[model samples]
Target: MTSLKLIFSLFIISFYSCSYVYAADLKKLAIEEFKKANYPKAIEILEHALIENNDDLELYYCLGYFTHYLCYDSVPLTGFDIRKSDEVLAYLGKAVELKPSYGDAYYFIGAEYGVRARRHLGKGEVDRAVFEFRLAREKGGLPDWLIEYGRNNLKTCDRDAILFTGGDADTNPIEYLQLVENYRRDVTVIPIALLNRPWFVQMIKYGIENAINAAPISWSREQIHDMHPYKWKTNLILIAVPETIKAELQIDKDFEWELEPDFEGRLSAGAAVLADIVKTNQWARSIYFSVACHPGMYHGLGDFFQSCGTTYRLIPTQTKDTELELDIKCIEDVFMDGDNYKSIASVADNNMPRASHMLNNYRAALFRLLIHYYKDKNKRRAKEVLDFMESTIREEYVASGALGEHLASYRKLLE
Candidate 1:
């Protein structure tokens, strides 16, 4: 009898483990419902799944996404109800509490808040919108597109050329045009600063040298024997790429290299250089570059920017693709006018003191460029963008922090 009881207990434990293992799959089913535009079905399944596994962290995360996506679908025109948004935000908040590491949870919470803040615009809620957008960038993993959108909107808000101020003396056409040109110019040249970055260059050289020496190359016996010559020659060539690229591009690498040591370094140097140009002319300013982080650079791209004291762009570079763009555009159009993405137009109109937000938008715009290019190619960059969804009491989605931490890891799995 005791042996039979023990066997029964073992069977029960196995069943429990199996269920948990399959939970993500079940949750995905609900996500499919979402994909098919069956929000009600998705919500229903998610609710049921959540009920069954109340402690499932991912379930909560998915529930948050379902609500967040719905919110995303509502914007300036179609519009989202603040009351409905509150419910979704509550779920997202719960998801974060259950799984603090769940980056998506944090992101959705911020996004929901951003919409609310925007909705409250002109009603003493501009500050609230800024707060929500900041949070969304922090947690949802700001991709370059989002940052650019936000940044442009911010510029619009600050410059006030298009609306509100009605093109006053401060919003002189030539002056505002110059501002746009200057900001765009800064973005086009961002890669120059990034590639010829001293620390980044130095680190890449080191890695390449090491990789070359260790790389299985077909070396002649004499060449192999002379390790000293090989090492010296390899190091020289490795260090030369930055200079070579700069020369070919006709860019001033030396000047960009000098703008390093921290984000402040970049911001201060840029501001200092442009001080006489912009009327305000602040001595030291913080410029936020909304960069999609990539691992190809020695320091994750974000850190490289931060190293110069520039605020890091709050987006992930890897996820940029045609589908994602469509997802955003579709969502954007669902809520706002198809062409009007000037959510931050208010900030620019106000002549906001800081230009950090403008910088972030530049980064995001660049990301859109990359995404546009990626869409033109026939290559399959991301290997594991699964079509599967999970089952839950509410809309549940599963995201792995470990998986999204670095580019190499993502390439390995995604490719």
Candidate 2:
């Protein structure tokens, strides 16, 4: 009996060991397919692996991740389709069940919820959207600093302004602030990435006309859908390019350029829609771009960009110098309040690359403010800016990099 028991235990141990090894090998193969952007195949391999090694935590997580991309890719208009969310969530939920402390799993789960919330919002399901936003806040584990970042960005704009935001980090938090907290419902938040889709643009037009009663976008749905980039020949101007934009671009009778498809030869639906807004609205309402936006999103209007705290307001007045035109009063109004600077600087250190990028943006802005004060010969304000930088930002962020060198050089200048 003892011999039989020993043999059976050995057999059980060997089976599990072989299973683990097989699962690991399958994981490797799946990852390779994922790297090649063959998301469906990657998901297939993982799904099969999970049958043999049901408890593999990474396997479940990867399955969730890959399914998310596949769902996003398969969607035609916008990538916020919630139909496959259940399957993705199930895999992530299992991963979390396997390891309750799995932070990445929790983050992805929250992200999925957030995306679903956006989809609901797009579909005009406000109640469902709010519920999903709440779920995202509860499950996403977004830091307080991010919420504050969103608040600060909103503060940068005037009441009833249109704010164009970019990417998940900048856009999601602002949406949360508006939909969930009811903080800045007056300001219309438009995601540039989604503006390419007719449905999203129509939703924005409806919301602007009905909810906010802002200046109506003149383009019909069909017009917006039909819009594409075209070359700028004087006789063949498809749409009337704003004189301000024309002057900014130095377009004369002899000048020729293209709008719509950017220099990369990729048509930018967002740019097309934005141009229409600018033309139709004629600055009836304020338009600001979050500083988090890529420069390309400015759509050749960089010359008119005036830095106002956390965003750049597009003014008609052209700037001659390429240097950033700072709204000094606005910057002081936003950042100089008691504890606000500290709060801005107090973003918790994390390994998240996005969070780190945001931190760098904040730091760079602060540095620009410091330089502005220094150039103005306002020693008191300059010293205050320097003190804020030293006191608030983590040392690790500035300990030994190019930022550190810049800070060291500035400190010597201040001394």
Candidate 3:
């Protein structure tokens, strides 16, 4: 018994020592990410740090601050995302509770309320906003950046249960739709590459099926392989993981699931299972891949998706041709274009990648419409599509060489 006690004590000491050693490094990494305008990544790092040592007040405060930047301060506020808003409060409140004298925490609380006020005032709902601003001023005057955030933010867009499998770039549109417009709430998001782990798959399986707090799955790797999504009958396949994990998997030919010859690059065990989930579930739900999704997924899915805006939505009957009318409308109005896009996309240097990516996808969709009409021998509609595509591409992505080539080539083909 004495020996057992000694071993347990040594284990505890080792754990604490390791956490203490890594805590400072974690904090430093999060700060660097913050400087790079990678708010989500920064928060993710600190969240792990808190797990290492939950008692770290500064970590809590930093977590709260970066989360605010992610949701409100960094971009032009578009929606009242309760999930994020409540999350901000939970972290900030924990910080405040941990250290009542943490004036910055108080300031953040107030600024968040001020953002709420700004949203309210936009709709001519003045009283609540005033109260929130007053609360903010009581803690600290609104920082210049926070003031700018609320000033530029306004409500926009609409959608129904649109879920994203990738990063902020892919998710922001639906976030605005659901939060600002209070549109749809049934969206389910599974973070990138989470499907790569056997444990994560089991978590997804049980967590989703049970609708409860998911404990880490203890299944062996073989167990994970056998637990295909086809068995689950889930709706939709969202391929968001990059190619890194894809190199590790093999498609089971005996399984009757065929990824395209040249296009099916590779799939991790978890990703292959996820694809099967969409396939075995009767192909009823839409499978959308973000621009970041491996090309293998895009091509291997083999004409299953109708490229719509930034996402390639799984369509049963055809490709982009059928969705041209509705999707073109979505592109023009909704696919992050025009002055609003320019302003929001300009705020952070890092944001440009996703913005350009989204614009590129929309451009490709438009070009597809042109080709669809041209092939149909519908000269009038074809010409109309060509005109719209040319003008919009030039307006949004003036510097895209590929887009320029597409315009020149497609124009020749149309004629």
Candidate 4:
């Protein structure tokens, strides 16, 4: 027993001597410093720790984060650019490999991918931007603030497609009719409220069976069915009604409207399983966002235009007499050219908790004000505001995925 205790004590002493010896502790201290915004001291310690132990994944990621923050700050003579995009990429790559299920590492890497996308953009690499953003969404952690921001901004065209709300009580009928039309175009609408029902489940199964037993050109129906039971069943149902129209349209597949109960979850899951679907498949980009209803005239139009470009002219002016009619028309214009009004960062920067609130109060306020400025046909103020947004987004901010790095401050406007 005495010998065993002596050996254990020796092992403990050796472990302590060989490891940290104050180095790992110092590395951790550096991370805390970085978190507290004392980057200079953090960098000093990180450099010390890295010299002693360069293979540490957390150390690399923290260093990468530090470098990224420095790049963002653009301190004079700080040589940071999208070229160093790979530095973060490499560090994150190792971090992820060292800890496969590390959510924080994934999140950081995803964020790095977003930055990579921006770098690619700066270097005129559209394909790379697309690739990085898709990967960011896949590996990036849950829908946290950073992820949501990147997702929303990076794929504005797609996500902006699905409008969540539309039409007042009076316009409900027309909207419902339109919804029916959309359903007809894609049969998933057939299931409607029955998506969650057992009957639909049976229908999907029957569809699968029928699809399988239909037989090939030369094979007997019985032979075909015998040869490929599962494949036939799965393929047939997949052709019926895919959950996202974008998915259905791209793969020539249909939805299992039966899957509506967990549609968003399915999107996230689909993003995971068919991770390459975004790059390889055109349909993945069809509807970037999947909200319930279509926004009417004054819908997401402003946001869309702000993010994209304003090549198209306004829908020809209409002589509407009533205020509600004017509002409805304006709303439609908002949806059609939503991208025109302001940079998404401008709209999103305010620390608003809920999008609904932003829509109701903040966004609405901006729209009213901008419209008011442009109402008297004050093209000059409109031009000035639009110019500021375009310049800010173009020169300052570099959005990677859904995550946008604000390059400049809009705070000056408030002042």
Candidate 5:
């Protein structure tokens, strides 16, 4: 009896060990496919892994994430059309079921609604979109990449300003501030991609109970350019413009229109609305734009907007002669390396998007900011910032492969 029991115990151990190794191998491959933007292949790998073990928590989360990415990126699945968003929701729902306490799961679910809202804006689905984002607020509060992105982007703005933006990457954290942490309670987050859609404009008006002037809800895309409608007492914040839209914008209207050709992507109705806001605002409330906003949105006013950390504070063109205050506060917040991203890199899956973003956007941005300060002749502050960066770049970032070895080389030059 003892010998038989021993054999059974060994068999069980061997089986689970093999199972774990297989799952690990599969996850690694799936992550690679995801990075390549080969969503179909990535999904196939995860689905096979699921067949091997349905209860794998990380597998479910990753499957949901990749599947959502496919639809979000407008890559239609062979049979499951991108319009069939519920399929994407189910995978995410499973992730939530497996780990209810995880705030990231909730954030992804809310993002699906944001995605769905953008698609169904014409169908008058704004209420449902608002509801899901609000639900995300209830569930999301963890300090992850998206939350940090939102916080860093908004830190430059005045308290209680309505900050307009778009994308799960950008807007989710802003919503996190309002709904979860209750930190920036009054700032209204408007996703500008949705603003490109006429129905969404009307929906925002109804859902937020804000009176948007000259919204042009009834106008067609082509007709939108003719009206000058955006007139609100509150300041206008230009959040984001899609690259495709940006490419279409006309950078400038030369005084000699006969000699100069008109550029293609001049805001049309969207740009017209911004022009009205520009005219009406008179800098009443502080007009700010996140640095992430496309340059096309500047419409010849690029010279007036100066980078202050993750955002641009609008300085009047007349002030080109006057010196502007250095935003020490923004630099301090963005570049501060109180604790490194060691814990995040150690635990994050091989292909986790947040880990890469942390390295690329936050860490790289800090490195550049260090150079900027030094070049601007603020040596003391530059050294102070460098010290904070040095603390993290070696062990937390360099020892681990989260950052390239080149960054270490860059540090040597900076010193």
Candidate 6:
């Protein structure tokens, strides 16, 4: 009986070893497919792997993550399938069950909840939307560094400003700050992509009419709901740029400029709404675009964007000859000052992919500052920026990334 039991135990060990190896190989293959944007193929590979290794934590997490990408990134190509959302939650739920301490899984789970919240909001289910938003914040498991980054971005705007955010990383954390921490409650946060939806426009209009948190919109309910892209015949005129902004950009007092639409000669729905808001708001409230936003999202107003920390404020005056200008004082005051700098400097290298993306944004901002100071021949300040980058952003993140190449070139420039 003892000899039989020993042989059985050896056989069990061999079976599990082979299963582990096979699961690892499947994960590798699925990741390769994911990297190539073959999300469906990646999901298929993971599903097949899970059939044999249902308890594999990594497999479940990958399935959840890849399904999310399929739903989000490929929506135009594959239509928004409700079934996929159910699949994502199920896979991620299994992942969490397998490992309760899985932070990445938790983050994505929060992101999925955020998506549902937006859908609920779009459907005018305010209570459900708020509930899901709160749930998203609770489940996010966001790192301190990312939260500080959101706070830093919020600090850039004046009171009652309208801030437009770009992606999940930028928008979600800011929402978390506002919802959970009660930070920057006066500022209205709008995600640019959501402007494409008529329901979102109606919602904003309702808020504006009811004197809710939204910035005032001049468009009537019908107009806002039916708003679409149109060509502008006149150049955007600016009555005056704030003197403080002028001093920051070193612009002459008499310098005046008008913004013309890009060569496309057409505005997107989001840009049209933004243009109208800028025209109607008339500097009563500051309008900002998060640094995470693409330049294309600027809607031909790129030249007027003034860098204030991690956000770009639209100023009435344009730079004379510079492609980009930084508000050095603002950066020094908000981003690199006491508590904020401490949060950034003390960020742990947790190796979270989302955290890495946020860190790259910081690195990009610092790189811009480094170039600005270097070109101005302020070697001391440039060196300070470079040192900060080296110290805060790990060498591993910079070794082969695009930022690495930029840093190498700048180091040569400094030398």
Clashes of each: 54, 1, 4, 30, 6, 0
Q: CA shift at 2, candidate 6, in angstroms?
A: 13
In order of appearance, the predictions have TM-scores of 0.36, 0.80, 0.42, 0.33, 0.55, 0.73
TM-score of 3: 0.42
Off by over 4 Å in 2: 1-22, 74-81, 96-107, 208-216, 225-260, 263-266, 317-324, 341-352, 396-401
Clashing pairs in 6: none
At residue 108, candidate 2 shows an lDDT of 70
Model 1 C-alpha lDDT per residue in residues 30-74, reported as the tens digit of each score:
989888866667877888877667788878778777766655442
Q: What is the C-alpha lDDT of each candidate?
A: 0.37, 0.71, 0.52, 0.38, 0.55, 0.72
- Alpha-carbon runs more than 4 Å astray in model 1: 1-5, 71-79, 122-415
TM-score of 2: 0.80
Which digits, one per residue and each the tens of the lDDT, describe model 3 over residues 48-109?
Answer: 89988898888988987788888754544334676887787678888868876565676666
Selected candidate, larger TM-score, 1 vs 5: 5
> What lDDT score goes with residue 177 in model 6?
74
Q: Candidate 3 — worst ten consecutive residues by lDDT sum?
A: 148-157
* lDDT for each residue of candidate 4 in 60-79, tens digit (9 for 90 to 100): 77776676666544334253
Task: Evaluate model 6: give its TM-score.
Answer: 0.73
lDDT of 6 by residue, 211-292 (tens): 2257556778787778776675546455555677567656655333344554367656666676666777766788899978
| lDDT at 275, model 1 | 18
> What clash pairs does model 5 have?
224-269, 248-265, 249-265, 249-266, 250-265, 250-266
Best by lDDT: 6
